[model samples]
Target: MLLEATDIHKTFQEGRETVHVLNGVTLSLARGEIVSLEGPSGSGKTTLLSIVGCILTPTSGRVVIEQHGVNAQHQGELARVRRQYIGFVFQQFNLFPALTALENIEYALNIKGVKGAAAQREAQRVLVAVGLAERLHFLPRDLSGGQKQRVAVARALAGNSPLILADEPTANLDSVTGGQVLEMFRALAKQENRGLLIVTHDPKVRAVADRVLKIEDGRLI
Candidate 1:
């Protein structure tokens, strides 16, 4: 399994009461599979992603990535492990406005300690994989919504992480573009042997997932 999350629970402290978010959510994702979590807004979809990505500490339960359990107490170690094992795609297409498509991908690799020609090579390769070789020089403002999301996917895959966690990846695109992205994800999972866990409300995206999981009232339904 690329990712295993067992009996996960998350609680937030409100002004005078406690808000229970995730309640004993357990999930496992294996390589070459696409799993989608479908939930309504404020249904703890993003919260669950945060916990599994090791960005937030679960109030209870354990998260293991490639068999290594995340230690919530050690913030630095958690950060390192998350960087080593997981890549993220977000709904907002969080690209740097100042950087071109290639530059944005290269920037991610650069921070991961890949530099110079190696970084450029990998960035180019990833963009090509996402069918964006011709858009390498286009800045975020110059690209269409679908193209921007493709860049985001390229960025996520640039790290060569075994697991990709995407939150509403196709939320911003039209149905046709969104379908294209979903198909691309299917190909990537098979070709690269990567595991994908996506959180989305779109039925079209859910239709493409190998497994669809629904959550409501902080519990998997």
Candidate 2:
């Protein structure tokens, strides 16, 4: 398994009330597989992704990636894990307005300690894979919604992490563009042996998934 999340739970205290957001959610992801998580808004899908991605600590749970158990209390370790093992694509395009598409991908590679020609080459490679080679120098504002999301996807994949987690990646895209992106994810998982987990309400996403999981009221059903 590339990733395993066992018996996860999350709770938040709002004023005097305690809200339970996740309840014993468990998931397993393997290389060469794509899993789609579907649920209504506020059903804790993103929360689960956060914990699995090592971004947020769960109230109680265990997250293991590549045989190493994650310690939520260790911020540095979590950061390292996120950098080395996981790639995340948020619902909103979090691209820097100041950086061009190629530069954005190069920045992620730079953070991973890749530099100079290597980073530039890798960035160009992923841009080509996303069919954005011609638009590599364009800023986020110059790109369409689908194009921007593809850039986000390219940024995530540029690092070549074993696991990729995406939250509502196709939310703003039209059906044709969304399908293209989802197909790219499927190809990556199958051809590159990467594990892909996507949280989405789009039926198109579910259609390409190897497994479809539905979360309701904090539990997977």
Candidate 3:
């Protein structure tokens, strides 16, 4: 399995009342499969993604990646592992405004200690792969929403991580553009053999997923 969560639970205490975000949530995703976490606002979809990505520690239970449990790793070690193993795409493009498309993707490689001529070559290839070869020199403001999203995809693809965690990836695009992005994801999963977990409420995206899961009131529905 690429990602696994075993009875994961988390809660927050607010004065006299406690807010439980995830209640015994358990799921597993295999390689080359696209799983959509379908839910409404306040359904804990983002909460679950954070927990799976190791951004937040669960209050109870455990998360396992590649069959290894998360509870045993130290904070710093776990974070490093997360960075090396997972990629993320958010609703917003989140690109650095000043950086060109090529520079944006290169930054991710630089963080992993890949730099100089080699970094540029890798970034160039990724940008081309994402259909932005001509727009490599363009800044964020110069690109459209769909182009920005493609750049984000290139950045995520640059790392070649085993698991991709995307929160509302289609929220910012028109339906046609969103469909194109979804198709790109599907091609990546099939051709690259990675796992993609997207948290979204769009019914159109539901059909693209290999499996559809709904969460309501902090539990699987």
Candidate 4:
């Protein structure tokens, strides 16, 4: 398994009230597989993704990436795990307005300790993989919504992380564009042998997934 999240739970204290977000959610993903997590808004989809991606620690249970247990007690360890094993894609194409498509991916590679000519080469490779070779010089604002999201996908592929976590990746896209992105995701999972866990409400996403898991009121039902 590339990613394993077992019996995870999360709670937040807001003043005098306690909010339970996730309740004993357990799931696993293997290489060359795509899993779609579908649920309504505030159904703990993002929370679960965050915990699985090593960005947020669960109140209980364990998250293991490539058989290594997540050590959420240490911030440094969490950051290292995320950088080495996971990549994230967000709803809003989280690209820097000042950076071109290629530069954006290069910046992600830079975070992974790749630099200079090496970073440029790797960035180009991923962008081309996403069919953005010609648009590499276009800034985020200059690109269409689908193009921006493609850039985000390329950015996630920059470090060649074994696991990819996305939250509502196609929310801003039209039906046709969303379908294209989903196809790209499927191809990446099979061709690159990467595990993808996508959090989305779009039914189209479920059509391309190997398995569809639904969450309701913090529990998978």
Each prediction's RMSD over C-alphas, in Å, is 0.9, 0.9, 1.5, 0.8
Alpha carbon lDDT at 67, candidate 4:
93
Global CA lDDT of candidate 1, please?
0.91
Which lDDT tens digits does candidate 1 get at residues 1-221? Answer: 88999999999999999999999999999988899999988888899999999899999999999989889889998879777888889899999999999999999888777889999999999999999999999999999999999999999898788989999998899999999998997788678989999999899877778999998878899
Compute the lDDT of residue 85 as modeled in candidate 3: 76
Candidate 2 local lDDT, 1-221, one digit each (tens): 89999999999999999999999999999988899999999999999999999999999989999999998999999999988998888789799899999999999989877899999999999889888989999999999988899899888888788988999999988889889988887886677788999999998997889999999989999
Residue 96's lDDT in candidate 3: 91
TM-score of each: 0.97, 0.98, 0.95, 0.98
Error of 3 at 90 (Å): 0.4
For candidate 2, the C-alpha RMSD (Å) to the true structure equals 0.9
- lDDT at position 13, candidate 2: 98
Q: How accurate is candidate 3 locally (lDDT)?
A: 0.87
Lowest summed lDDT window (length 10), candidate 4: 184-193
Model 3 residue runs over 4 Å out of place are none
The TM-score, computed over Cα atoms with residue i paired to residue i, of candidate 4 is: 0.98
Query: Which runs in model 4 stand beyond 4 Å of their true positions?
Result: none
141 in model 1: Cα distance from truth in Å? 0.7
Pick by TM-score: which candidate is best? Answer: 4
